[model samples]
Target: MSVTTTSRMRHLLTYAAFVAPAVLFFTMVILVPFMRAILFSFQDWNGISSDIRWAGWSNYTKMMSDTGFLKSFSFTIKYVLATTILLNVVGLLLALVLNLALKTRDFLRTAFFLPYVIGPVIIGFIWQFIITRLFSEVGKATGWVLFQKNWLSLPDYAFWSLIIVTIWHSAGYFMVIYLAALQGVPKDMLEAAEMDGAGRLKRFWHVVLPLIRPAMTINLFLAISSGFKGFDLNFALTKGGPFGTTESLAYHIYLDAFTKNLFTYASAKAVLFFLVLASITLVQVAVMKRREVEM
Candidate 1:
């Protein structure tokens, strides 16, 4: 081979070596399972039986007529809205605070992010105990009747509890993302704004927010997707109790596939859920991308 041809072949080999592992991993884990799910969504498999009958749209039809499925769908939407808003708001506030020149800024950031580092399963169990048992004692001691009730036992309270837990877990994560974006905001611009007699509120509204729109886009997408797909925390906290009021789409999928053994139906629900999340995320990205202003 000529020298140029030999160099090109070497580069190709190097590139293939670098990409092969990731390509193989994705094909085995993600692509295979995704393809299986699509196939299963059209079948009547009980998750165990060898007789996999092709059911076509029957699973989708059954899901539409199922009231429990509809309730879970609505509950998932409520959870998504509440948790997304709260996560972004709290995360932005925390980011703003940490952006300041505090003495313990690094320590405080680590402390806030500690909850996020804990496994979701452990966080769920920890919060479940605290909300159910520990809060009762504290309430009795402090004479706060609001905390005296079974928090996880009541539908409304349980819903809020889930929101609070999700926010507590995720806010720090998004805060870190926002903090990085905030750090990128030009100090000269902020100083000029201050020199022009702009108040802190005005500067943040006109200067900081517009510059940090990219981070907001990312944080919003993360919050919305994670909120809609939340399962472990809700499962551990309430298990969709209080007359199945807290059941989300994810938990419903779990119940259908595992608990009820309706694997094919659950696959259909999963496919629909995936499509809804994808559409919403795409729309959000398109709208937010337009709003992003270069710093």
Candidate 2:
């Protein structure tokens, strides 16, 4: 081969060497399972058996008749909305507060980020005990109406409790993302705006926020996805308790497949979930990207 041809061949081999591992792993880990799920969604299999019957659209059709599944889906939506809003707001606020050069900024950042490092299931158990025991004692001592009830046992309070724990668990990680973005905001631009008689609040609203829009976009997407498929925390905290009022879609699906032996039904739900979440996230990201471009 000519020198140029030899160099091109070498480059092709180098690129393949770098990309081959990831492609193989993705196929083995993601693609294979996803394809299997699609197959499973079309069949009636009790998660284990020699008998696997083709059920066509029965699983999907059954979901329409399944009120609990429908309710669990609606519950998931409420959770997504609550966590998406609270996580973004609280995370952004924490990011703004900790970006300041306070004497305790470093310590505060570490403290804030610590919760995100802890596993959600463990956090759920801790909060469950705290609410059931510690808060009850405090309520008895202080006569505080808020802490008097067993919050986890009540539907309304259980819903709010889930939101609070999710926000507390995830807000710090998103805060770190926002903090990094905030640090990237052009200080000179803010100073120039200040020179133009723009107040601090005005500068923040117009300049700083616009610059950090990318991070906001990312945090919103993460919060939505995390909330939609919420399982571990909901499992550990409520176990869909009281009257199944706090049952997340994930837990509901888990019950259907593992508890009720409706593997095909649960697989169908998972497929629908993947589709709906993907569509919503895509639309949200697109809209936010457009807004970011405008700003």
lDDT top scorer: 2
| Candidate 2 local distance difference test against the native | 0.93
In the predicted model 2, the residue pairs found to clash are none
lDDT per residue for candidate 1 within 6-124, as digits (tens), equals: 99999999999999999999999999998899899999999997999999999998988899999999999999999889888999999999999999999999999999999988899
Give candidate 1's TM-score: 0.97
lDDT (C-alpha) at residue 131 in model 1: 95
Q: C-alpha displacement of 59 in model 2, angstroms? A: 1.1
User: What is the C-alpha local distance difference test score of each model?
Assistant: 0.92, 0.93
Question: What TM-score does each of the candidates earn?
Answer: 0.97, 0.96
Can you tell me which runs of candidate 1 are displaced by over 4 Å? Answer: 293-295
Candidate 2 per-residue lDDT, tens place, 1-295, comes to 8999999999999999999999999999999988898899999999988899999999899889889988899899999998999999999999999999899999999999999999999999999999999999999999999999999999999999999999888899999999999999989999999999999899999999999999989999999989988999999999998699999998998998899999888899999989999999999999999999898
Summing lDDT over every window of 10 consecutive residues in candidate 1, give the lowest-scoring window.
286-295
Q: lDDT, candidate 2, residue 152?
A: 94
Per-residue error for 160 in candidate 2, Å, reads 1.0
lDDT score for residue 241 of model 2: 82
